[model samples]
Target: MTKQHIGILALLVIILPSCSYFDFSPDLRFCDDFYVVVEEMPVLIGGMAELQQKVVYPELARERGIEGRVTVQFIVNKLGDPTEVQMVRGIGGGADQEAVRVVKQAKFEPGKQNGKPVCVQYQLSINFRLEN
Candidate 1:
């Protein structure tokens, strides 16, 4: 072969090895039933007396005797702790406080991501009922 042809072949050989170094292989898993079931327990409310005490029953609502529901969202940490409680839906008076207080005081079993327990966002709904 001509020197020029030989040099070209040698250059191709040098470039091929470098190209192999960039080869990527990714791990993949497949399952016929790729479904994972997660069972969530019901969050307990009215368990903390301190939280109950902080709930404000609006005098106006009490006079009118309005009973409603409040929805709150929060994060439960990997340590099975609750934090960042905010009211998504609020009812005037002590209902909102009651919702926040109860949520903050409530404990969670934490949540799982990929079968491992991790911090997760949780939502809670609290109902305020006034007894005559």
Candidate 2:
């Protein structure tokens, strides 16, 4: 087995789930209704240290030499639960699935705009690295 780390970036954070599950269709009005360019981005409830403890590096990924960053896009609702998790880019060999698993289980603080909690789109990248 190897060591891995998860890095997250808040690119294109929309208001919330405006479309169906995993459906990021182009609808100009959707942004106004549910999307929000949040001023205060969501945060992991317990921080990265908590996430690091919960993440399980898939053994399959380690044995197969599948290592890299897996970028996942998802929506964090006003209640801070991640939904509609989507893998924008992945390294494959179970790394993608594992990334999704971690994101789904992880909780956020819920993005805010104008001092009110709102939904937002989120992207997180989990890196798979082999121990030397």
Which model scores highest in lDDT? 2
Best by TM-score: 2
- Candidate 1 overall Cα lDDT vs. reference? 0.65
Measured with C-alpha atoms, the lDDT of residue 104 in candidate 2 is: 87
C-alpha-based local distance difference test score of model 2: 0.76
Span of ten consecutive residues with least summed lDDT in model 1: 27-36
Question: RMSD, each candidate, Å?
Answer: 11.2, 19.4
For model 1, what is the alpha-carbon lDDT of residue 16? Answer: 74
Q: What does candidate 2's lDDT look like per residue over 60-127, in tens digits?
A: 88888777988988877877888789899998888888889988899898888899877788888877
> What lDDT score is found at residue 51 in candidate 1?
47
Off by over 4 Å in 1: 1-60
**lDDT (10s digit) by residue, model 1, range 1-132:** 999999999998888768966654431211122112235532344454544555666677688777898899776665566667899998777677768876776765656655555556677677777976
